[model samples]
Target: MSLLNEKVISSASEQTQAVLSFVRAWLRGEETFEIHTSGSTGAPKRIWLTRSQMEASAQATAAALGLEVGMNALVCLPVQYIAGRMMLVRGLVLGLNLIVVEPSSDPLAALPADLSVDFVSFVPLQMKTLLDVALVADDDQLSSEARARALAYRRRLEAMRAILVGGGPISPGLEAQIRQIAAPAYHTYGMTETATHVALRRLNGPQASDRFVPLPGVETGVDERGCLHVRGTMTGGALLQTNDLVALQPDGSFIWVGRWDNVINSGGVKVHVEQVEATIETLAAEQPELGLARRRFFIAGLPDERLGQRVVLVVEGAPLAEDQEAQLLRALIRALPRHHAPRHIQYIDRFAETPTGKIERSSTLKLLE
Candidate 1:
């Protein structure tokens, strides 16, 4: 048995037992087992996972990916999360040389240059930083130091059969940027409960913007509300219901809409926060000179004394004056609906984020208290 780090074995109470069972089955050639949820939906909970399921997943991945054994796979996400933990599993099961590094904005800095890595997985944030920096950080495309770093990354990327990207939304602008660079990127969709991604959407090359194709032996369908529901032996035949709203295409691929839980109720109208955020981000992206910026704002339904709920826009920055906020709201209303307009604008200095860089909405709202 490989030396499992203490961090790898512990999270919630059942995590240790789950990991131990997975190892026992792996050593016994049993194959499949259960993992845990990422808790993005509700709370982190245990789910059935198996080594055989993962092997089947790995085989399907290898066949689809053309991964060669002995090539290196860099693991940057935490092993506690299914995505990060599965990187090692996939590497070990597939005979790839696994290099583990602490999750950071700059994973390459912590690694040795001599060892060549063939594959890597990163969230959209990390990918954005890397690709964005390589493109805009320097005036010269081929400077001595810049060339060396780009060459290092390009070699590693080209050597890889595939690179899995997941954990958050991959914006259209970011996707275009990745495509422009010809990065071997695949956007993955699956929760921690599903043992990383059960579906893969290719985001680069000739097949850009392709629909997510389910892993072999996995079946998918949408509920009455159009939320995705997945069931597979890979997940121990558990029927997993997700809050993610999806548009099921006739072609068997589904397009993800905003989360059902992401909807905000203001007065009598229901507004999707994601759509509003995207609009705001689109407006911001029109400007090209906001170097290395972090913009996070969300719509919340504040408790109103008269109306059932009032619309509030919580952004991260210093508070604006009443007139300034009113002017901004008027500008925003031209693009958004009148009811969708934010009533109160609150400025928070910073956001509380998860280990994976996802903004913790509960924690962020708590600051208002």
Candidate 2:
């Protein structure tokens, strides 16, 4: 075989090397392999997964999406993360022609204009970047040359049959933009423990669902704490209880409530951080002072002498001025019920995020300490 046929990738980064090593090992009949969790809620840890498990996951995903052999898939996420790694697994097992690209906030920028991408996966950050670029393309104020490049980006996205957005929350603004795309964009829900997503909520189209419905062969319900639990072939039939709170419906679909860890028991009232954060997202788009449309924020619990724990709002970026703070507080109070109101406000120069782009609510709040 020629040197090129030897399957050597020269000048590749360490991450790409790791990806190749793992995939090669699996292809070589390796049974069990260790993978790390992104650890958005806790310390990172390694766990073993089998080739059979990954293959089963890939088949499920392919079946769910109606992916055929030799279809094209673009992979732009870090190969280390589960979402990114699964894209590779899907390519190998589902016989996709994988077009791998370096991790970026704007991976589409590197693609060929005429490339036919059937499916693609991105975090909310990447989606936001693409949406922002698409907006610029439609703006008549831009130079013709600039608009042409941006139009190419938008066209590439519209050409995809499916787009999967996960790894973090999709803001309302991004979701609205996704609706305008011709492709059916979906919000995926799952973690490394589940070998990627076991359920999907369509973000666009007439069949768009408010609840996350599990893929075939997956079952979902809530544990005693109202946290989500999975029992299915995807989970190896072992019940995998998650920290995510959800309203598990009788129809086997689930409405994600929030995270139990971020819930605050303030004066015996239960306050969900995720719910408040969703409200904040809406306000960010409406109010100029909050600027949360581009900024990030989360609700946290702080110890209080009387209430035991008080709901606190933690915003990303420099601290707000007294007037700005007051405006934010008023907006938040108006939207949230009395018990759900944040008792305190804090700011971080930058919010801590997991490698996969999930906001580390607890650790980010710790920065204020």
Name the candidate that leads on lDDT.
2
Model 1 alpha-carbon drift over 4 Å, by segment = 1-36, 141-159, 288-293, 304-307, 320-328
- Per-residue CA lDDT of model 2 for 1-369, tens digit only, reads 011111222323665676688678867988877788888879888877777777888888888888888778887888787888888888888888777677888887666566678899999989988888876786878999989978887878787888999987777778888888778889999888888899999998887877888988998778789999887676787899899989889988999888788788999999887788888888888887665667777887888999999888888887788887888888888899997988578888887877767777767877777
Per-prediction TM-score, please? 0.82, 0.94
Looking at model 1, residue 41 earns an lDDT score of: 55
Clashes of 1: 9
Clashing pairs in 2: none
Task: Tell me the lDDT of model 1 at 359.
Answer: 75
Model 1, 1-369: lDDT tens digits are 233234423432443444445446566776444555565556567766666566666766666667777777777776666787677677768887666666777666665566666678888878876775555434575678777777665555555566788988776677777786554679998876667777889898888665888777778898888889888765668788988888777755777777888877766688777777766666546632321125667777778877677778888877666666666676667767877767668778997776556777778889999
Model 2 error, position 135 (Å): 3.3
Which 10-residue window in model 2 sums to the lowest lDDT? 1-10
